[model samples]
Target: MLEIKNLHASVLDIDDSEILKGIDLKVGKGEVHAIMGPNGSGKSTLANVLMGRFDYVVTEGDVLIDGNSILKLRPDQRAHLGMFLAFQYPAEIPGVRPWQFLKAALDSKADANGEDKMSVRNFSKLFDEKIEAVGINPNLVKRSLNEGFSGGEKKRNEMLQLEVLQPSLAILDETDSGLDVDALRIVAEGVNSMRSPERSFVVVTHYQRLLNYITPDVVHILVKGKIVKTGGPELALEVEKDGYKQYMAEAEVNA
Candidate 1:
């Protein structure tokens, strides 16, 4: 459902700081792929570039969703195309409550996709159901979007958004970061519940702890902006055991 073709991207302000170098990947419908690498291996960069973030420029290659190019589309347009990105550091919108933020986002996506906007009554019912499913305290959501929320709460908040939005392709960039055992398990359960035949996921993370609960169909070792190795779930265990030292050394020499 998602394809990245020889993608190359670099920081817009610096000419020499190329982050992604010829990344080629294909994720099929219903597949879950895990991308594991060391710090600064361009994992988060890939996520940001896919969303058409303005800070980075794609110098070569293309990103296609269901055979259509999303390279030139804006971030909102990409969201409308069923691409959702759970940020590593989810931004805090202090003035907006979760209810208001989500309703507007759903309406915007509906208008962009030519779908009918969800009525308040229906949205309220669904929102309440998801809030409970994600184990979020209703009072917390009423406060502000990621405002004054603890680390675990923010992660659960992302899961709540995912459950409510139900995007086609979900790219989770280090959602497991800063999460404790219980919080991590809750987030993984949230992701597991969302898996389906029509939905795909690309989870970018540094550790394999999250992978234990959400077993991925494919595991990729991305080093120095390139995917150097691809394998089954066992690859993650290998990374856990041997670490990324060998891969990092090899990639730095070649990449």
Candidate 2:
């Protein structure tokens, strides 16, 4: 479970322009929430701030996971508390093989949970199973993480991390972008397989196409760094059909 209250965050320089203004959201276990917004609505900023990115300054309010404040925690500490953010654009880390990265992640998580470290052979078996489930080539495990990978491959790699890490709350920041229909299906399947009463997801996307694959329990429309409306899955269809014109008008009236 996660709760954000009156969150006012801003860039850390010059005028210190705020991007997330008085946000209030609650995500319970077994829930999927989709945030749909136009460009410059601060969706990505919310994701980064939740991950404890240093460039953003929190001017007010707090972020709590499982009833404890995490505003002061380091990025790794927040990660240890079962938070994962799949970026809109995954970075390519040269010289870091997928196997090595996964091993480190597994070990770190194991240490966090006070479990025994996994052996290389055992981890390889688990990795093989997950990679197969996500339909990723086993050969990719030997290559640098995301290096020279196709767009779909990169998205699959992020799903691979989702499967391996198994965090309690996964925030996917536009994972469907740049993905073809086949790739989107694969990614959606991967996410769906992980849905459980003990887990939740926050999917931030621009289009309703992704929602067709991963239906959210709630859909929120964000405007001008604030959530202007919240509704069920039907709202996604309405947005796709009529666009954000109505939502923008409502936002202007509220402003």
Candidate 3:
């Protein structure tokens, strides 16, 4: 469903310094791929570039959804084409209530896709149902988006967005980073519930704990801005047991 070809990106306006050297990956429909790597491996950079973050400039390569290139599309344009990125650090919108923010987002997507927006009555019913299913407090929706929310609450809110957005491809960048065991399980359950033949997930994490709950169809080791290894769930276990020292050295040698 998603393809990255020789993707090379650099932090814009910063000496043309490259972060992603040459990333090539393919994620098929109904597949979940986990990217595990050490810090400074450009894991999050790949996610941001996929989302068309302006701060990063893609000097080469193309990111495609389905088969068409999305290099020229803006972030929201990518969303219109069924791409979603759950931020590692969710931003707090001080004055935007969760209900308002989500409703507006869904409406915008609907409008962009030439569909009718959901009626407030109907939307409220569905929203509340998801809130219950995702185990988010209904009261949390009344507050400004992520404002004053605990780390777990923010992650829950991210899941709530995923549930409502229903994107074809979801790229979760370190969703389990700050979450405790309970929160991690909740987040994993939320993701697992969304898995299906038509949906795909690219879960970028540093540890294997999250993988325990949401087993990926494929696992990849990203090092020095490129994917050096791809394997099944067993690779994650190996990384957990032995660490990335070997991978790091191999990547340097290859470089």
Candidate 4:
């Protein structure tokens, strides 16, 4: 459902320090892919580039969703095209309540698809159901979005968005970070519940703890902006046991 071909991206403000040299990846429907790497491996950069973040410029290649090139599309345009990103660190909107924020996003998506807006009653019903499913208190929805929320709560809120929006492709950028074991399990369960033949997920993580809950179909090792290894779930175990030392050594040799 998503394809990246020889993608190269770099920050435009500096001397154009290249982050992603050439990232080529393909994720099909119903597939779960995990990108594991050390710091400065361009894992987060790839996510931002896919979302068309302004700080980074794509110097070469293309990112295609389905069959269309999405490089020219704005961030909102990418979202409208069934792409969703759960950021590693969710932003805090102090004044916006959870319901209001979600309703606005959902309405914008509906309007983009030429569909009628969701009725207040229907939205309330679905919202409550989603909140309960994610183990969030209904009263929390009335509070400001992610303002003073615990790390786990923010992660759950992200999953709540995933549950409501149900985007075709979801890129979860370290959603498991800072989560306690119980909270991590809850978030992982929420993500696992969304698996389907029509949906796909790309999970970027540093540890294999999250992978224990969500088994990925393909595991890719990214070192120095390139995917150095691709394998099954066993690859995650190897990383967890031996760390990325071998991978880093290989990368140094290649460089």
Candidate 5:
């Protein structure tokens, strides 16, 4: 349902700062793909570019969702198109509670799609259900969004949003970072529960720990801003055993 064609991007205000180089990927509906790479391999850059982050300029390439280009759309516009990016470092909104933030987001998406917003009572019911399913404390969500929340709490909150937003394609950028064993399990469960025949996920992670819980149909090795190897789940195991040294050596040689 998502396609990236020769995707090249560079950071704004930096000379010769291109990060992603010629990234081409195709994720069909119901599929799960994992991107694993060393630091500065442009994993997060790809995520931000796909979501239309303004700080990064797409020097070349086109991103298509269901065959239509979204290069000109803003981040929110892409959200309305069923694209969701769970940040590696989720931002804390100091004054807004999760309930308020999510309600307004749902309303906005509903309005955009010419659908009626859910009533407060129904919304509350669903919200409570989701928060529980995602293993988030209801009391914590009542507080300002992500403010004073622990790392695991922030990741759970992201999953709660995913559950409520129900995006067609969810790009989770290092969702497992800073999470402990329990927290990782909770987050993985949240993602696992959301998997379905009509939805897809692009999980970008550095290690194979998260992959143990959520097995991906495909695994890609990204190095030096390019995807150099693509394989099945076995590739992740190989990376875990041998590390990315070989991949990095290959990438450098190719470069």
Candidate 6:
């Protein structure tokens, strides 16, 4: 459902150096792919570039959803096309209530797709259902988005967004970071419940703990901006045991 073809990207207007050397990946419909890598491996950069974040420029290659390029699309435009990215560090938007933020997101997506607008009454009902399913406190929705929320709470908020939006493809960039065991399980359960034939997930994580709950169909070892290895869930276990040291050294030597 998603494919990255020799993607080469660099920090926008900052350097001519490429963070992504040549990333080639293909994720099938309903498949979950986990990208495991060390810090500075450009794992999050791939996620941001896929979302069309303006600060990172794609120097070469293309990111496509169902065979169409999304390189030039705005982030919101990508969202409208059922693409979602759960950031590693979620921003705290003061004064924006979760209810207002989510409702507006739904409305904007609907309008962009020329679909019927959702009424507040309907949205509230749907939101409440998702809140219960995702185990988010209903009271949390009344507060500003992620403002003063604990780390787990922020991850839960992101899962809630995923549940409500039901994107075709979800790219989670280290959502397990900073989460305790309980919070991690909660987040994993939330993701597990959403798995379906119509959905795909690209989970980028530094550890294999999250994969214990949500087993991916494929695991990729990303090093120095390139995907050096791809395997099944066993690959993650190997990573957990042996770590990314070998991958790092090999990637550097090849560079």
Q: What is the C-alpha lDDT of each candidate?
A: 0.95, 0.91, 0.95, 0.93, 0.94, 0.94
The digit string of per-residue lDDT tens for model 3 on 156-195 reads: 9999999999999999999999999999999999999999
Q: Backbone clashes per model, in order?
A: 0, 0, 0, 0, 0, 0
Kindly indicate the candidate among 1 and 4 with the higher lDDT: 1
Writing each residue's lDDT as its tens digit, candidate 6 over 156-231 gives 9999999999999999999999999999999999899999999999999999999999999999999989999999
lDDT of each residue in 60-173, candidate 4, tens digit only: 999999989999999988999999999999999888999988889899989988999999899989999999999986677788899889898899999999999999999999
Per-residue lDDT tens digits of candidate 1, residues 1-255? 999999999999897999899999999999999999999999999999998899999999999999999998999999999999998899988989999899999999999888999999999999999999999999999997999999999999999999999999999999999999999999999999999999999999999999999999999999989999999999999999999999988887895
The worst-scoring run of ten residues by lDDT in candidate 6 lies at: 12-21
List the lowest-lDDT window of 10 residues for candidate 4: 135-144
203 Cα displacement, candidate 6 (Å): 0.1
TM-scores for every predicted model:
0.99, 0.97, 0.99, 0.98, 0.99, 0.98
Q: What is the per-residue lDDT of model 2 for residues 1-255, given as tens digits with 9 covering 90 to 100?
A: 999999999998837599998899999999999999988889889989999999999999999999999999988888888899998889999999998998998788789879899999998898898899889987876888999899999999999999988899999999999999999999999989999999999999989999999999999998888999999999999999998888888878887
- Clash pairs, model 1 backbone: none
List candidate 4 stretches off by more than 4 Å: none
Report lDDT (Cα) of residue 146, candidate 2.
94
Per-candidate Cα RMSD to the true structure, in Å, reads 0.7, 1.1, 0.6, 0.9, 0.7, 0.8
C-alpha positional error of residue 245 in candidate 2 after TM-score superposition, expressed in Å = 1.8
Ranking by lDDT: 1, 3, 5, 6, 4, 2
Q: Which stretch of 10 consecutive residues in model 1 shows the poorest summed lDDT?
A: 246-255
